[model samples]
Target: MNELRFRDVSVRFGGRRRGVTAVDRVDLTVPAGAVVGLVGESGSGKSTLARAAVGLAPLAGGAVLLDGRPLPRTPGRHGVQMVFQDPYSSLDPRMTVGASIAEAAPRGGNTTAEVARLLDLVELAPERAAQYPAQLSGGQRQRVALARALAARPDVIIADEITSALDVSIQGTVLNLVRDLQRRLSLSMLFISHNLAVVRYVSDLLAVMYLGRIVECGPVDDVLGDPQHPYTRQLLASAPRPGGIPTALTGAEATLDSAEPGDPHHPPPGCRFHPRCPVGPLVLPGRDDCRDTEPDGAQRRHQAACHYAAHASEQHNTRSTP
Candidate 1:
């Protein structure tokens, strides 16, 4: 039972900047009771995809279905909730923390009981219920925000870099809280972040995005442990490895820990990584057919638009880990 699914989704702003398509033809699925990690760099449309899932961004094109239902015309406040990156600002500076959670209660729902219930669910003491946003620490503030989103008991939760600014220890604490909450409530979550380490730690599946489209995606362990996509491998390798030599390796030649960015607007004709690709004839021999044109963002579920997926897959099957 998939809780939320995005099919050929695209979100574009009509303002200046030539109306960039923020979430481009992203096809994704949040299986029931799973924490799917939408991992990528900032502005990779992770947040936009989250917003579209919860109805904050318009569905410029494609479908965002909740529980197999196409997004409703009016996505109610309690339908899908968002936990912003900055907890301090995300909470109402003027309102008490308890009040913020109270605001999320459905009109007919047991407002007081639900608010208190969520607060407890997030591991907050009953006494802290009266505290204001200014009275809490960063972690505490985030807990309150999580409580607020859960107050509505939303079916889907879109957490965009929610723990990014917190101390590392605090991040672990908060991540544990989310993990606990997900299990306890059997919730479906879309955890958006640029932190691959964290994603590797928490998510069941991962989606790697660049420019706007998702370049690669699959089971987290498989994708992170043995990435088939060059971009995915580069991203995994980018993190500073302890006691390891820091050297630059371009494209396919690079290890997963040394990820890199590529041209956005005008990606390579066959594959976006062709210019920086360590592999020869990026589209490769058998994949020469894919060189005719790059696939649009529309096909997202388990495919990379790259012309070299087959070759890449074959390489993955034959080569040693980088």
Candidate 2:
């Protein structure tokens, strides 16, 4: 097992002065043999952070490290691999699935046997290797993408919304397969998703992002059961319940649609989420902290980048205590 660390990472697109900052000074770690799930709404930079880990996205600041060593800029095989969201686009359309997986095998390895083994590992039939991406269902294609990532023998795998494009019925199967593979292979993973329910199902740790910054992070149970950040609370509230009923947002948490997120090219000076924050000045008239000061990012377990995080936690504890 190998640990992957993103130290104060930032990703900017376009020119220096006019570019948009997709990821802003994020500090996250995928611990050895553990799965860390990064969750957020669309355009919140979850995928950008994943791309930074595998060198797909250039970092404007900070470094991506594997086992305390910086990743090589000129990549051949860096022990870090990514499984993209769209399987059809990720795999070569002209190549056989066998050939696609074989291309990722390390030098001098037996490509034929390697391809079969990978196919079996992902629960696909060995014969499926002879077919093309178009021949496979969305779910199977995603499994092939996972197999391709594994063929690299990577120490860390970044799965960027790998299930979002698939049908809801197939999503569960893929999620189960991914969890099984992680445990059986002892793989370190950074699973990115916009669905809190999906992230909660597969992650050991959970990190929530707003705009380009992480607003809260902690063990899955802690963060989901008692979300300290308002944005996290809103996400949780919007998630469907066990019987497919939507969890209604009430009081301060009901303001998710009151305002849109700020532009990435010119993010708000203070807390980026303040404009739409359910618990900010929109509800608490006298409170201006969210509009004036940036809350500290997650620096410890169960931490949240909100001035009222402690208060919220305390209130929850009080309500739940017997």
Candidate 3:
């Protein structure tokens, strides 16, 4: 089985004065044949982590391991491939769809046969291969991109916001294709998106990132249904329901300001999220722990990084004590 492990990984850019720490000692694993979803706001380092897996982002500390070996600097060199967000830009507008998919085919492989098979795998008609990117719909283009990724015959495919650009209806079709493909091929995937609903749909395991850290990680349903961290609760509360209505989150007001991502160069000290953590007081009780402590990303069952995760547990136990 091929497993992707991020061991104490960190990514820093620029100098001490101007440098930002995009990813901070995050340890995560995508077991073979599983889909792991990473959900976080823009600049939350989710994309940076994805980039690190594909060797696009340099790591300041730690490493990325594929089945106990280091990931190659160039993707698809060792069965690792990435399907980027914008198919329009990722695919060559100048080249025909068949040509693009053929280019990604394994070395020494029969390109024509591979393109036909991949296009069929992604549910595109064989004739569609003759179409150019400009002639295809957004969903069709994405499927073609997926076909291209499959042509590489990768063990792990990093899908970075592949559905974010499509309409909601089209998003579901693409998501279904991804889920079906993963199961059919037994492929491991690291799916990155900010859409909670979409992530919940496609992932078996979910990791929620805040700022540059994974604040929560667990089974998809468990974490989203019974969120342990304050941020998780906040996200659940803020995420829109089907009717286009924001679910009314009790306790803290929903206030995830749509600001540019935080400066990695100067993240707030203590808990990076303490400044906006509404339920911190409820969980931390009478301490300033949240503002002065850094919680390591050690998963305890469905782990959460807040200092008050234990406190909340204790409180729950206390309430249940008979």
Candidate 4:
């Protein structure tokens, strides 16, 4: 069985002293035939992690393992593929969709037959293969990207916000296609997005990133229904609902400033999230522990990096006991 494991992986850009740490000691696994959703804010390093999996980003510390073996920095070292957010930009406007897809197939393979099959797999007409990217809709172009990724026959698929550029209705179609393909092919996938609802829809396991660190991770329902991290809870609360009424997890209105404040280049001391965690100071008041010590990180299947994970639940329970 194929599995992609990121063991204590960390990614930093620029010099050690001045560089920004884009992905902090994050450990994640996308087991064979499972779809893992990674959700977080725009700068949470979700894309950076995905890029690392595909050899785009270099690891500063730790390793990215494929089937328990560390992946080499060279391209195609592991059978991992990626689909980007902008399908239009991902494909070459100069080449026909068929040519683009065929380029990814193994050398000496029947490019024509394979292209047809790939197009069909992505729910596109075979004739559409002859069309240029400029001739396709946003949704169709995205499908072409999926077809190209499929042509590689990779063991793991890293989809980086693939549906973020499409309309809502089109987004659903693309997501459904991904879900169907993942199940049918028994493919391991890392679906990255900032939208909670979208992630919740298609993931078996959910891992939440915050400021380059994985703040929470577990089974999809467990993390979504009972998010252990305050950041996770805040994201859930701020997501807009179908009825136009936004739910508040802590009665605080959603705003641009809801995210924890800290510099990516120079993170805060102790808990990177303590500066903004609403309950950390209250739970561990005047102790300096919350501000001085980072939690022991992930434990077991469900992990949360919070000093208040134990007491926060009790406090929430008490508040809702009425």
lDDT of 2 at 264: 88
RMSD of each: 3.6, 2.0, 3.2, 2.1
Q: How would you encode candidate 3's per-residue C-alpha lDDT over 13-86 as one tens digit per residue?
A: 88887788899999999999999999887889998999888888888999899899987666445477888999
* Position 75, candidate 4: lDDT: 66
Which residue runs does candidate 4 get wrong by more than 4 Å? 249-260, 282-287, 317-322
TM-score for all models, in order of appearance: 0.85, 0.94, 0.91, 0.94
In TM-score terms, candidate 1 sits at 0.85
Q: After superposition, how far is residue 66 of candidate 2 from its true place, in Å?
A: 0.4
Candidate 1 lDDT tens digits, 1-322: 5488899998887764556677777778888989889877666778888878777788888998888888774555465788999999888888987778888776776766777788888888877878888889999999999988887768888889998989888899999888888888888888988888788777888888876777787788877776766667556656556665433554446532333455444444655555444443542455454445665433544556565565666775565446
CA shift of 126, model 4, Å? 0.6
lDDT of each: 0.75, 0.88, 0.83, 0.86
The lDDT, on a scale of 0 to 1, for candidate 2 is 0.88
Distance from true location, Cα of 13 in model 4, Å: 0.8
